[model samples]
Target chain A: MIALEVKKMKKNFGGVKAVDGLSLKFEKGQITSLIGPNGAGKSTMVNLMTAMYPPDAGKMIVHGVTLEKWKSYNMPTYGVTRTFQDVRLFEQMSVLDNVLVVLTERGVFRSLFETHGELHLKQAEEILKRVDLWKKRDEKAEDLSYGQRKLLEIGRAVAMDADIYFFDEPFAGLFKEMVKTVVSILHELKNNGKTILLIEHNMDLIRELSDHVIVVDAGKFFAEGEASDVLARKDVVEAYLGE
Target chain B: MDYIMHLSVLVGVYAILGLSLNLVVGYSGLLSLAHAAFYGVGAYGSAILMKDFGFSFLSAVVLSVLITMAVGVLIGLVLSKFDGDYYALASLGFSVIAFGVFLNWRDLTNGAFGIFGIPKPEIFGYKFLAGEPYAFLVLLAVIFTFLICYFVVNSSFGRVLKAIREDEKALQVFGYKTTLYKLAVFVISAGLAGFAGTLYGSYISFIDPGGFDDLVSVNLIVVVILGGLASLNGSLLGAAFFVLLPELLRFVGMPDSITGQMRQMIYGLGLIALMMYRPQGILGKFRL
Candidate 1:
């Protein structure tokens, strides 16, 4: 079944159309990759999906309701979670606190006086262990190596229990081992029937990891279908690999 | 001997001030320019109550703290909508309004003539009035408040605040409503600032609108930044310097005319230099 459907989505910055009549379906339990050249509006699409930016005209159905109609805090209702192009972790907080932050139950007044419960702490510990960051959990997030910070953020997302995971350039700047850590996590996620939409420039990774692919060039979908076929297209190659 | 006692009490007062401001400015990364307003609120809230209602010191102090904090929460709700220098401006507006209250609320606040004769705090059978005995009480309260801050900053709740400071969006992705956290921190900080004001009022037995000006707010900022943002120990050191430096001006042999202006200039200059030399502050090893 379609887990997320974008119907005639359009976003504009002043006169510039960042997302122009974009329409796509993300299925539950499939790994989908949105690939495009630089400035191809990949990040903009992610932002629109996350409700960070509202489309000028569009409808997004997440888990059956139009996400646009829901409040900003309920974006997670779509079971969606995402990361930034640049890693954003609480700088002064210990690495463990990063994941623990996500694990805490949030409400307006209750969470303020509420401390992290045992379950939350357990969940954070479990995720950190998976990311191999349990050892460094006491260290500040900013003190981590580039690779570890990315892993920590990924761990935080993992603890969020989002059904539809939007990973924005999850493998960017990661070392080979860290990339494997991420890939393995994705594999585990897909095996458990979690929907994932990945934004990536690495064609090789897209071909290997994605079950489906869509190519956008200059704010419009230039190509779609099997990753192998799309990567071989003249337009896709021309946009990324150059003439 | 009296000067030494005053120095310690002053240190205790500003230390509480610095710590309260630290909750917002340091940990939460909110540049609050209206802290002095809340500080004023606490002072005036108690002042008016004690002066007109003839309330005892204990009741007046409690009422003042609550009233100031209530005002603080309202301002926090509004300030929560803004950040960076914009948040600063919002706080600045609150400070200005508080000043207006101090000036225009004539019958209650004595119309800028100020509130005097604020009785010493009477708790149980013990009394905290002038002299070393009162200084000890201030010291105890300051220690208690600072300990609370230290614990809060080290707790998971405080980490969430720091996270919001680092990247508000990051907190959202992890499924947090950062606006709520920011407002919570603001209210807490404001309440502590009000508590400081209550102590100030009871100690000095006098207060007026002039004390809660924008410059006072700036001075608190100077203290935090100098101590270093997000560092509790650094804030204490900064508070000590801020409260005692004016007293030290006597030793420096500067003329009385230049004393106030020169001390303020030094505070401003010192903050700038610290931000330049060690943007992290004296003990802030982490960058937010």
Candidate 2:
């Protein structure tokens, strides 16, 4: 079953076509990877799907709902969450606070004086432990090591418990153990029947974790399919592996 | 002795003012220039309720806080659509409009003549008259407001505000509605400013339009950023600087005319220095 459907999508920055009439489908509970040469519309598609930038002309269907039906909520409201290529956390805030912020209920009708209940603290603790950041919970996010900051942001999104997860180059700067930890998390989330979008350059990690693959050049979908089948294509092979 | 009493009350009032503004600019990362308007609203709101409606002092302050919060909600609705420089300008416009209303609406606000003869608050048979007792009253209110803001900004909600400040887009992708959080923090910050306004009106025994110029707004920011942007204790330090500057001027035999302008210049110079050297202010913990 298709979890995400993109059709006739186009995105242009001034005169540059970052995503040119791209179309693709993501299957339910599948780990999809987007791989291509530099300047591919891979991240643009992810941003569009996440509703960061309004689509120039396209239709995106998520969970059997068309673009019209999905118009009610932006990226955040659609139960979609992501991590940036550059790790961004509330630097002055503690590592625990970074994840804890996600657990907050964004309800404004509630009085300003109302406090966060015990459940929020519990969830924050669980996510921090998952990222092995519980020990450094009190430390400022800025004070964390490079890899730890990445893990902290990942922890925040994972703790967010969104329906669709987008990891934009999650493995770019990770150490081996940290990479292993994230790889295991991807499998765990996939095992639990979640949709995952992996935007990465590490072919090994992509092959290991992605159930499906997508290739974009410029702003258009070049190809997409089962992870093995797509990666086997000559064009994808040439563009990525340069064989 | 009389000057010291008045000074103490002003310090306490500015302390509350600084703390209220802190909730917006410090925690929520909003550059709100309309805090003094809400501060004015609070002062005038409580004054009207007590003098016209014949409500008790406590009830009047309570009503004023609620009314200011309602106004905050309205501003939040407009402000929720804006961010960065536009947000600051919009808030400043609000302050300007409110001051205009206070000046023109003579029947309600007595125009520039303003509301006078506001009686001291007497709660539960304890009178908060002028001098030491009143200073004590204002101090307690300032302390209470400080503690409340401190506690909230340290809580989970406060953390989310920081998140919104740091990375609104990242938070949005994380399924957190950044707009709602922004509005929530705005209303909270404005409400606290209104609370300070109530104290200001009672402490001064009067309310007027000129008292709420943009300079007052600038003064509030002066304290918050000078003391430290996000430190809970920074508000107090800011309040001290604002309240003590004039008295310190008296010691140096500076004339009143030059003292006021000199103080303003000092504030400007201090802000520039802080932004250049220590953007985080004194505490240097939460850099905006």
lDDT of 1 by residue, A16-106 (tens): 8888898989989999999887778888988887767767888888878875544446677568888877787877778987887777657
- Least accurate 10 contiguous residues by lDDT in model 2 chain A: A68-77
Ignoring the other chain, what TM-score does chain B have in each prediction?
0.96, 0.97
Error of 2 at B196 (Å): 2.1
lDDT by residue for model 1 (B129-236), tens:
688988998898898888889877766678677778888765775667788888887877888888889888889998988888888898898888888788888778
lDDT tens digits, residue span B170-275, model 2: 6666655667778777787778888888887887888889988777887888899999887778888888888898779978999887988888888899899999
> TM-scores, in order shown?
0.94, 0.93
A59, model 2: CA deviation in Å?
Answer: 2.8
DockQ of 1: 0.54
TM-score of 1: 0.94
